[model samples]
Target: MAAASGTRPEHMAPAEVFYDGTEAKKYTSSSRIIDVQAQMAHRCIELMALPPGHRCFILDIGCGSGLSGEALSSAGHAWVGTDISADMLTVGLARGTPGDTLLSDMGQGLPFRTGSFDGAISVSAVQWLCYATQKSHQPYRRIRAFFASLYRCLKRGARAALQIYPENAAHLEMLSAAAAKAGFRGGLVVDFPNSTKAKKYYLCLVAGSGERDDSAAAATSAAGAAAGAAADSSSSSASDGDLKHSDAAMEATDGMGSAMTSSGLVVAMGRRSSSDFEKRRRSRAQDRVGAHAPARKEWVLRKKEQRRAKGLPTRSDSKYTGRRRPDRIT
Candidate 1:
């Protein structure tokens, strides 16, 4: 719709299919999405460098309910949101083209021409990307290609920033490597607070000059070397302290971006589970981070799952790990 897609539904839309009714999806009433948008907008205000009424061309890669668009408008900028889901786009369009909302996937290669936007911001998107050049959900390779496209799409110095939540070093490593190949300059990967109780996350970002994208390249190279160093440093230390310490090297990011079709915008009641909390785990471990305060919810969920599996009291009485076998996520 609106010059994004001709008629077919590509995979770049941001609205999830199961939640189109919009009663109880995670991001429907979930305020965390807004929290991140607020933070993203703050960054955009500085990064875009646009004056009032400048009519800056903007793209919200995975624009869900148009939260990013709302934030951008508040900052005095025009916006164009494109997603794959008709339902989600419906939600986005309801806000009326505060700018221009379209339906297109970043993976399919941004439908817009080169230098079409002054800035691009992707919030909790990108990390969920899996489509690769070979097809069949090659998430990592697709991520790399997406970045490379960004480099060609923007002008020399346009700002292309993304915030990802990496589950561990592996996540960050993949992003670092791809961003470099994709042609980003320097990016700041920082530390943040997280807790098992509340499920807090950290942001790993790749931000800098689109002109040279040196920082992104450096990040990729450094990450490669670091991976080598970590592997060489201690292949023998399997102890708890060593293994835990291994994760210490993983940092949060402040920026990142990409595209996807819409899915999961609205949902039937009772479809969400506590596990949804960790859906972005890999991405978080790779980018976005929030307050890290220990909470007991994780342990509680673990106990509930155990109890449910054993056909015991639905209520758990002790601390546990929310870990679920991959087969059980559905």
Candidate 2:
């Protein structure tokens, strides 16, 4: 909830210390938090691309107060959730959440066995691993250990869609690198990237060789395409009021051979081709050489004329005054 208002609770305290009994109850009872968590959970499942009509045993990492677990159950999947906060798990038990809850620190690594779950989903988690709350906690090592354990617990070809609120580009890069190092294939899938409030980052990862059913792969691709379409639509809508301005700005940037977009999205607009780069390089080289080269004959003559008009003695102009002599025949 603090993250919603631009305040990161992870910065204030560790997950276990922040989400105490009072905070857990408040988070569970908030309608907005419940709805947002549910939406993100559904999106995570979509990104997972689980087979249709088949029940899956999923792992819900950092399933705070079982809100996201409730979503997994709604999709007809059985999920076991793990959280670092005991009070949160207690509150989830009191609420009669469908999934079983375990009290464990994810940064220490998941407790599940190898290939135990069909897929995994995490909502508003993972970012905590990038921060060190204890003296023994090394962000990179903890991230590496957590991802390694998660990768082992997942069946080959299974996916884990973890929705994280990265603090910055560096944190995002660290998490991604750690996941890749753990042997998971795939990359980040960002939805509604143009909107500050609606933008979400999902690290969609595949376990092992990624030899999954074709239908599942198609589903994943379709989901990614749909997210792209949504982002485009949102961007277009946001710039509708300033369409002409946006177009003009884009044109100016393009004219300058810049690869930046007018709306500041990651989408590149005026990427120069190889020939364009070559031409620009040649032009710059010519300018650098010309800056230090001797003045042309016409320039020397003009300067002499200016000196004469200033009443200073100047060289007389003749046919050869600004002409170079021919080379003698060898």
Candidate 3:
């Protein structure tokens, strides 16, 4: 749809130009659009994998008219929504959604502190970040900045599900690459992957610095180190195996580029869960399982406890606990 009487949709309008005044009113009052937004937002929240009855702080990006926020609010989630259109936020205020709303361009990056939000959901909003309405607006940089900022602000182990409408394979890859580079672990999960009309592309993301990811990384690193050690120890097939392992890791990234075929865009009507993510994750973890360090001997812990009971100092309960022994170590 055109932003103004003669505006072309290809040259997308700024959020204010397209969603303010009459446009905002029309959108807020439209039953069809509202329903669609509600459904998509609900799906995005589901993809976040929050436990049932769990109330969390959520971020609603491109929260036009607060339709998406309404769903989150109804679910008893506290949210802070942002949009580039003040008119939309005004409508949201009128509706009395249970959350704060801000007029801000997401392309410039979110303003929340690191680890501020438990999760994030953007319904029909991320795609807008792909369009540059101003001369200074570079889509790649903007998208990267937004995802990078988002990655930092989410709590460890938190997920974000972005429901985006990419114009083409190139656009989709562009967004996915940026997310991956920003250290997200999940991928483009297409709900109803076989149905063109019903298919939804959800960029499901888990913060890469989370404990799960750290363990995965440590596993992969251990695998590589073990492979190196084997290569040095044996002068037979081990060397070839190490070369194959390195080659496979390098080859894995080849498909991350803009190599998706046009036919690949035609999603059929079939909903599939993100099982592949789990599969690959487990595979990586298994690859290094054999190299896992042996558990610490029980005697080490026993001795530490013995020393503590005798009023001697031992390492704090945890690395960060820093609970020093009382005065004389007792």
Candidate 4:
């Protein structure tokens, strides 16, 4: 069946693949959000000062391809990531990074038991929830639900860092209000000295000791259904629908019965930081590559040696590790 006039955004659909698209691809190579990583490491180091078992349990929501996970793992923090796109997850899984990765939708209530996470972080992913709404779709609530679900899964006394885009007063107000209502405290931090786009935003929210909001779920469900319906069909000519639908279908090379028209994301990290978050992030970005990963290379070489010894194919097109050697990243 044809997709309705407004389904997924332009950068959505096989949304997982966008992780490799130009913007994120650049961010990946250059580490544009490297500062975010440093901040995360600094906060984690501070948390480390706490007695054992006190360090935060991190959740990287929409943690596309484990970019954030790799950073957290490198710094020695326990983290788990979840996203709706398995294709993205596949890349992450292949990397064999530390921590577990789950496939789940951010717009849905997370799979964790209540308050299971110590803190949560999201990067370059929330904007998908805020895509322009059609007449009948309440895209705002999807954005709201995205935050609400994060609030529900994180423990009290924990923090959340969310970065959102198209920086404007209106969006800031929307984020602040929704977070407070969902039981998080600690005001907004706007870090843009240049322009809205360059403006780094941080919502360093501390979950309240108060009770969770009961009404968000029903409203969220209604909104998800609304998003599922795509935009209103009555207003746009049936004529346009055919053309738009045809275009969307033609663009969907990855299947999953969806496509994106346009997309953007702002990444943010949340955790317990007395104040060292920024410093830690800066230090982390500058971390030296250990002169050598001899142990790591030895392990890989041994595996290949073992395969060769056993007369098994040492190289193959398959992505499985034991099945074939790897294409190393830095």
Highest TM-score against the true fold, candidate: 2
Per-model lDDT: 0.49, 0.76, 0.67, 0.51
Best by lDDT: 2
RMSD in angstroms between candidate 4 and the native structure over all alpha carbons: 24.4
Q: RMSD to native for every prediction?
A: 20.2, 12.0, 21.0, 24.4
Would you estimate the TM-scores of all the predictions?
0.51, 0.70, 0.63, 0.51
- After superposition, the stretches of candidate 2 with alpha carbons farther than 4 Å from their true spots are 1-5, 213-218, 231-330
lDDT tens string, model 4, 94-123?
Answer: 667577999886655577777888667765
- List candidate 4 stretches off by more than 4 Å: 1-17, 20-54, 132-137, 192-198, 210-330
Q: Please provide, for model 3 over 12-95, each residue's C-alpha lDDT reduced to its tens digit, 9 standing for 90 to 100.
A: 566678775777888788776677688778767766767578789999988877899989988889999999888888888888
Better of 2 and 4 by lDDT: 2
Model 2 residue 220 distance off true place after TM-score fit, in angstroms: 3.5
Could you tell me the lDDT of residue 281 within candidate 2?
Answer: 90
Clashes of each: 65, 0, 6, 14
lDDT of 1 by residue, 62-128 (tens): 7766777787887777777766556666765664647677776566567776776776777655655
62: Cα error in model 1, Å? 0.5
How big is the positional error of residue 113 in model 1, measured in Å on the Cα after superposition?
A: 0.8
What would the TM-score be for candidate 2 when compared with the true structure? 0.70
Q: After superposition, how far is residue 214 of candidate 2 from its true place, in Å?
A: 5.2
**Candidate 3: residue 73 lDDT (0-100):** 86
| lDDT: worst 10-residue window of model 1 | 259-268
